[model samples]
Target: MRDPVDKLSAMAIFARVVERGSFSAVAREMQISQPTISKVVKALETELGGKLIARSTRQLSLTDEGLRYYAECRQILAAVDAAEHSFQSGKERIAGHLRIGSSVSFGRLQIAPRLAEFLKRYPDIDIDLQLNDQNQDLIREGLDVTFRIGELNDSGLIARQIGITHRVTVAAPDYLRQHGQPQSPAELSAHNCLQFNLLNSQNLWVFENNNKRHEVRIKGSAQSNNSEAIREMVLGGLGIALSPVWLFSEDLKAGRVTAILSDYVAQSLPIHAVSPANRRQSARVKAFVDYMSQALDAAPELKPVR
Candidate 1:
């Protein structure tokens, strides 16, 4: 009888061939001969009693059965790799590819600077960081972790509140002088409001004063999906902007911009380190969350707008 271990090995080789799109490529990656890869795939197909892949001179594609089988193979392979990793590291030291996602501005200003320190602490871990303004589907994208600003609405994932940031109504010193500062939320309608397109209430500026909250619709000539662009425009005196305090802390400190309506500051947005519930026990994900939690806690720039 054919050994089960040998059968699994052949299936793994077949999966690799499909993943690579060519037997030759799989052979090169696995450091085996092309004939060996082809034989393994053929053997796998025979054992399964179905056509797994369609091969032609110019292209290769997976049949419907092959696609389903490939998905299962990937899961099994991942489990096998995780088992080996557990044996190697004893589940203490993190060692694997960790894919993290974050907002462009926050990732560049905050997370990027601290990555070197994290790498030094865990030399075995490999990181892939993606920064974008759009919210990513962590599980769908196979991400290990993500940094989310503002209130999270996705109920499928588990979120850890790492830190909180306040929203500040700010304007360039020149713009404030030219248009006058908004002393109240009502006055915000008169000023040009530089808007972040990603915010849920992009045109609405919310403020709280004397235990009462108000939302005011704002209009401006300028709007941008990228926060950095909006920041630049605000600095150039294009318009007033309601922004996260951390995004403009240095500018505020340097007097490039000044906060307005201090008495009616907006509610705080809690920053979350979110991950799929199943991956909460992953060592690399947990390590990164812990590190970020501590790092963000110490960052004074993220303090409440005062």
Candidate 2:
């Protein structure tokens, strides 16, 4: 019989195998032979006295016991990582891979442009920036941090409010000239409104003026899940859009688009740097979030209009 193995190491390997969904993939990641990886997991199962993984030619799956064990393993591993991270000193602690997520337009316009300077400051760090319109599971995607716009729905995340997305109702000059400017919130119904379908209330627009509120349900010729696409539609003179002020700040200055409904206030969304609550925040993640918060605070377009 084989002597007792390092159970913590074996548990980590098992977790990675399940996370990657392939034994070969985990083996390649750890730079170990595939058989050795399999043996480690098998040994872990043997010691635990139950099957952890069911393997086939196509994929790997967890049994009921494995699922529960895997969940506990993740929490324990994260705690270990956090404990180790706490011991490293100063800038030395901030060295590692950071996986970041954000919406396409925000990532492109705000985060991507600032990365060069951030990289220059922390040369030891590497970043993987993933931009998508859909709000996918951050833990499943292995994201260390994500920039979320609007009110957060995921109670499982720990969020820090980094900025405000001050919204505006805007249209291209050509569109306004053709459709006429909407003088009041109620008049928006007479115009073509572009909707960003990702929001729950995409078709419903709310405005406030002098303690009075107006809710308008609008219809349009176009609807897109992406904010960039909505911006494009507004630029093409197809319709008016209610979007973040940063989205069209340059366009507003350049006369490409005009901000209407000045008498009323469009709802502003909060920008948050979110992380999985179960995982402890690493130094790199904290550093990045702090840098982003400071950078965004200085941005004029993200500031709330008084």
- By TM-score, the best candidate is 2
lDDT of 2 by residue, 246-303 (tens): 8998888899999999889998788999998867788889999999999999988776
The residue-by-residue lDDT of candidate 1 on 135-232, one tens digit each, is: 98674455678999888888888889999877788899899779887778998888899889887878988888898998899999999998899999
**Model 1, 53: alpha-carbon shift in Å?**
9.8
C-alpha lDDT values of all predictions = 0.84, 0.87
TM-score of 1: 0.78
How many pairs collide in each candidate, listed in order? 0, 0
Q: Which residue pairs show backbone clashes in model 2? A: none
TM-score per candidate = 0.78, 0.85
lDDT of 2: 0.87
| Model 1, residue 305: C-alpha shift (Å) | 2.6
Q: Model 1's lDDT to the true fold?
A: 0.84
